[model samples]
Target: MLTITNVTWLDLLCLTGVGVYLVKQVLIKKNPAPYPPGPRGWPLIGNVLDMPRIKPWLTFAEWGQKYGDITHIEVLGRHIIVLNSTKTALKMMDSKSTFYSGRPVIPMVGELVGWKDSLPFLPYGDRFRQQRKNLHRVIGSRAAADVYNEIEEVETRRFLKRVLAKPDQLQEHIRHTAGAIILCISHGYEVKENNDPFIDLADRAVFNLSQATVLGAFMVDILPFMVKVPVWFHGAGFKRTARKWRETLEEMVSAPHKLVKDQMVAGTAPVSFTSTLLEGSHVSAEEDHAVKWSAFSLYAGGADATVSATYSFFLAMTLFPDVQKKAQAEIDAVVGPDRLPTFADRDSLPYTEALVKEVLRWNVVVPTGFAHCVTEDDIHDGYYIPKGTLIMPNIWFMLNDSRTYANPEQFNPERFLAKNGKEPETEPRTMCFGFGRRICPGVSNSHQLTNSLHLANAAIWISIAMSLAAFDISKVVENGVEITPEVEPLPGTISHPKPFKCSISPRSATVLELIEQDANHLVHDNTL
Candidate 1:
């Protein structure tokens, strides 16, 4: 046991460092006010052991019930403030955003993999404001975003044909369609129907991002010093992983941007977010980098969120046939069987809109949300929050809280409608996109304002409407018995509905003809 082989230097280094960290923390002055209530963390390691390895939002929700709305915890000498209620989150992150809009630079995901330039991990500063302003030019308002309706309609129609051909590959079709639309919008690039290089590259990068951001997934995140450790050292495998992931991420960010630039030089670049920003400007190296990264962020953010929501919509349709039937009935009355529903028809279909809202509310995507870093030392609600504290809003609990939503577990679109003289429940879009200055750009908003056009929400609505109009989705039958899919969301930065079985078929021959007609139209139309 005393031999060096039995106990490596890494273990010794970690233990010694923990002891030093604890001693240093103990020598510091006490808090100005007590931290908001939370689980009592152990010495040295703090709450590291108490933190859940999976679905931490569930644990955070339990903490919310036990210790008021705001819960505090410390891990590796870092303070975290978990806001479990919308009211508390709004007051802290919204009303006082000046002190709470910063994002903690994750060692593994950011510094190691060079993802810091992207919005999800970007710090709140002038750069952040600039990127938002850039997005404003493209998707800032509904009218501005409507400029791309043909693109959305074209790609979505292709999605229907893909689904019709390969019903078993529904998720793949959704992923492909999402990438295709975002690629067109971001760089005017067209993705291949199968095994596209750009799609493969971006998918691998995003998966790595989700894995890298998981709490305690890699030791480098906790002991940031580990990043500086030699790759040759034992137990330094994550460095190798970070290297490979960084390459993938670099390609994901640069490849499409390069394509746009090359096309621009050739005098044949289509109008897109990237092209529009670069066309008339003699851009400096620094400005060019900003444009490239901002375009990638727009693509990454809008695409991933749409995939999650659209996939969840299918899961919802399978799980609740009654809801699906009700939605289809409304669609039938409003849209009819002659053609599929389009964005122009969205306002006339209230029940379908409610159904889409319910899908969003019923399934919590981005469950815990990315952490919001505190920029200054401030006391919130009589509790002292240190300058570098990470403020995490448990968005799942807020959406599912029974106090706000009656029968919160039920999949009922009626909850969003005024029925029997009862008012509608609080809108989920207001809370789901997140809070404050760092609220997700281009995400859904309750009131139409001068912000990005809620691309992900818009994509989800169009896909759901068109799919419902074209197909009937239900549980699969095997061995003469219908199989119901189990409801579970896989844990990650972007939560996705677990794999499920469903049967999708054309609602009528007319719908199939409609899909064919759209495809024929796209074949002739080069603008899309």
Candidate 2:
């Protein structure tokens, strides 16, 4: 009934969108090859209603069980291919990485929340390559990663002190230490023992990120055009929320950068990833922006994974006392209680090293990984994968796949150690950090176990080793009843173990001296 004169721009836009949607569906061409098998979805909406809202990796694993490894589905005319096995993910993402490395257009987190500038969300192009180059200069290899070993030792020793002082607040201490170490390495700014502004800002922004990146949480992600709607419009509350989060994200990204720049101007900026990069003769705007976000990405890269894995290590120790005792024995045999374990002692403590691997495998920090957008149309494994298809890897299921590990659910460090005639299971590093070009810049793809200490989590390894040597982690006895924590990880893009009580105390009265060993000094000076 409305004529052009009566039609508002919003009305016209909605009409055009509906027309386009219908036409696109009607004009769809036949496929060259059949899609990989998946549960059948209804017409028009396709699998929109079938998408799992919580713990999607478990659902993806079921699809894998029924339909084989590579399962495919369509939502709103878009292709979403899920990989349930390491073999399929590696074959395509590794072999055909040229196009498989592209990132999907995440409207909520990427565009609206302003994380599109981040390395993980950047599409495969010059900008992505430039950012990768920046990260590689600092942590490209294990040797490159080792340059910050001093930082790791200092922060970890501090972590041990905080843990001894307040054992019940273990998670807080782990997060604080991770933030301190990453901040020092990324921006050369040290965190205060009490509340620090940058850390607080980052924590808020990161929690927002965890909420924002959840698949299907925001409708704008599924329908990109929704971003065009006004914030005041009904059902546009997500727009306002995204705007607030974006502001927090921008502050977190820019504040430390401005500090580094100010220090550089005053000639007092200590050596750091940001300081080192901005030391150039002349800086362009694009390069400066890349440096700012990449440095934030460094903290983002390390803090969550480190905190999750380290906390899970404590949880595993609480539940599996025999494993804890065995690891303690290994630490005791290799490095005496008189001195704390150092990175130099890592190789000597193979059992502890295996324990670290088990921590990564068991916790499964990132369950369902970031989706890789296919940049070109192609055929893979007899499947017709078109351009713009999002390939999601089910990392949790892959790590837990019964075919790969002996008892996937059990917290057994011995799985990695070869005994009587059996070799260790497949190295989970290949699956955990991701595959191909989009692999996390923090982790090393090295074939050696010693080099498994990623630039992001090398501190985690040292912290675990030092903690085992310095303290005894066990179940808490309350009201004469020992509390055994459950094996459950919270749902999110980055999974964290549910809070559980545990007892942490010095192994002996003498170990207190080791905890107070001037963490700010020693290790850094020896290397310097």
Candidate 3:
């Protein structure tokens, strides 16, 4: 009996030891793999607590100082690797694009909105391939040139009219003008004058889309099984909002699509993208999903970016009037007072080109360029990134790096110009469009269109340069003390300046007559 009891006691003690070891392994240990260094964050919620609800860029930049070029954090089981430097970003995201080109499989967004098959945000695969090919056909460099003059004319005239009418709402005026150009080109619809239906529809769609990307939109993203549960027990609010977004988005897309379809049936539709896509002779019958996803891609890609660029133009103009003055002088010298600047005189206006490059680098619209996912286990700088990891190119950090740009915060267009005894190894274009095979295909065309808009704006700037030239652009005061102004951003993937007050007036009537004559010619047949 004593021997049997001893054996039983020994077995019990061994069992307890094993249990302790297992518990320690499961709960009290660090992650075995060597991940990139980042700040110590709480369990299950990583650097998310460090991020801001708005202007997360500032926080990310702060973190970059401590963590060096590449920082890694796990947010609720999601491995987010932020590329904080240009060399690392280009080396990994660009050089190894095939291994890191897929987008993070955003569960709620991918399943409901058909992002699983969309071009810009789709995972790297056959669906993405087909959609990208089709989009390239429509908005690629050569094709973009075809629509350049129309976009330039429409945006310029619309912006001028808005500035003339509602000088107080300059930011909104730029937004409306930019949104109108993208809508007109993407679909056959144009937003005219003030509060046009087309503008309202596009604006609503942009807002809804922003809601979908919000960090807390869908809790199901953090817990996958929630998707299997009933909607009432899950992200019920997200589901409802997503449906509303889908409806509003469909309204914007369907209007133009319906027109194209009706015109095609009656044989009168113009040669717009929607009309051409409807013909359906080019795409394979098996690839119907590609067609639908591509339509959404058009709206997503076109609207937010142009608006952000235009907003940057205004901010740059206000902060650095000397740059504006130089650009305007160049425009006047090339085009003369007899006529407004045209695309034909682009090369002659190098200062204007430099200004555009500076604008792109100064305030990047998409600070963290679209996140790309690692499709396969990759080795970078001796670090092993597991397959399915989320890789972010924190591009704003790169653009603002002092190593690349002198006095990075200041708006200096002359940095782009090749001055005497100075050589820039990397061109200004390197940071603007994007990196790698996914570089914005519409860049060349957008560059030209932006230049034309800038020239016309230069003329406008010259016309009114002296009038509002000395006008103070400082924040408004309440009760005699200068109030600390809040920086407002439009709620979307693209961040633009929020509305504020600035004074505007013509320097002289002589300059105003030139603007009036230019507006008349623009309003005529040559405009669109």
Score each candidate by Cα lDDT: 0.84, 0.85, 0.60
**Per-candidate TM-score against the hidden true structure:** 0.95, 0.94, 0.80
* Tens digit per residue, CA lDDT, model 3, 1-528: 444324442343344445544665677644345788877765434454554556656666777899888887765446778777888877886778788777776766666543444566666677767766766665554343344454555466546555756677876776676565555554555566678876777677766655566544456565454456554642345666666766666676557656666777898765655555667576455454465556556656655666666656666666566776777777667766555555566567777767766766776766766667788877688676877887776677788889888888887778877789886424445655556555543343223443323222232222222222222233345678754434466654556666545444443454456445444344322111
Q: Is candidate 2 or candidate 3 better by TM-score?
A: 2
In angstroms, how far off is 246's CA in candidate 3?
Answer: 2.2
Candidate 3 segments exceeding 4 Å error = 1-33, 43-52, 112-117, 142-147, 215-218, 228-231, 280-289, 424-429, 440-492, 506-511, 517-528
Candidate 2: segments with Cα more than 4 A from true spot: 1-21, 446-453, 523-528
lDDT of 2 at 32: 96
Candidate RMSDs in order: 2.3, 3.2, 8.7
How would you encode candidate 2's per-residue C-alpha lDDT over 113-148 as one tens digit per residue?
998988888888898889888888777767777788
Cα lDDT over the full model 3: 0.60
By summed lDDT, the worst window of 10 consecutive residues in model 1 runs over: 519-528
Q: Which sections of candidate 1 miss by over 4 Å?
A: 1-27, 444-452, 518-528
lDDT tens digits by residue: candidate 1, 164-269: 9899999999989888877888888888989999989988887788788886688787777777878987778899999999999999999889998998889989
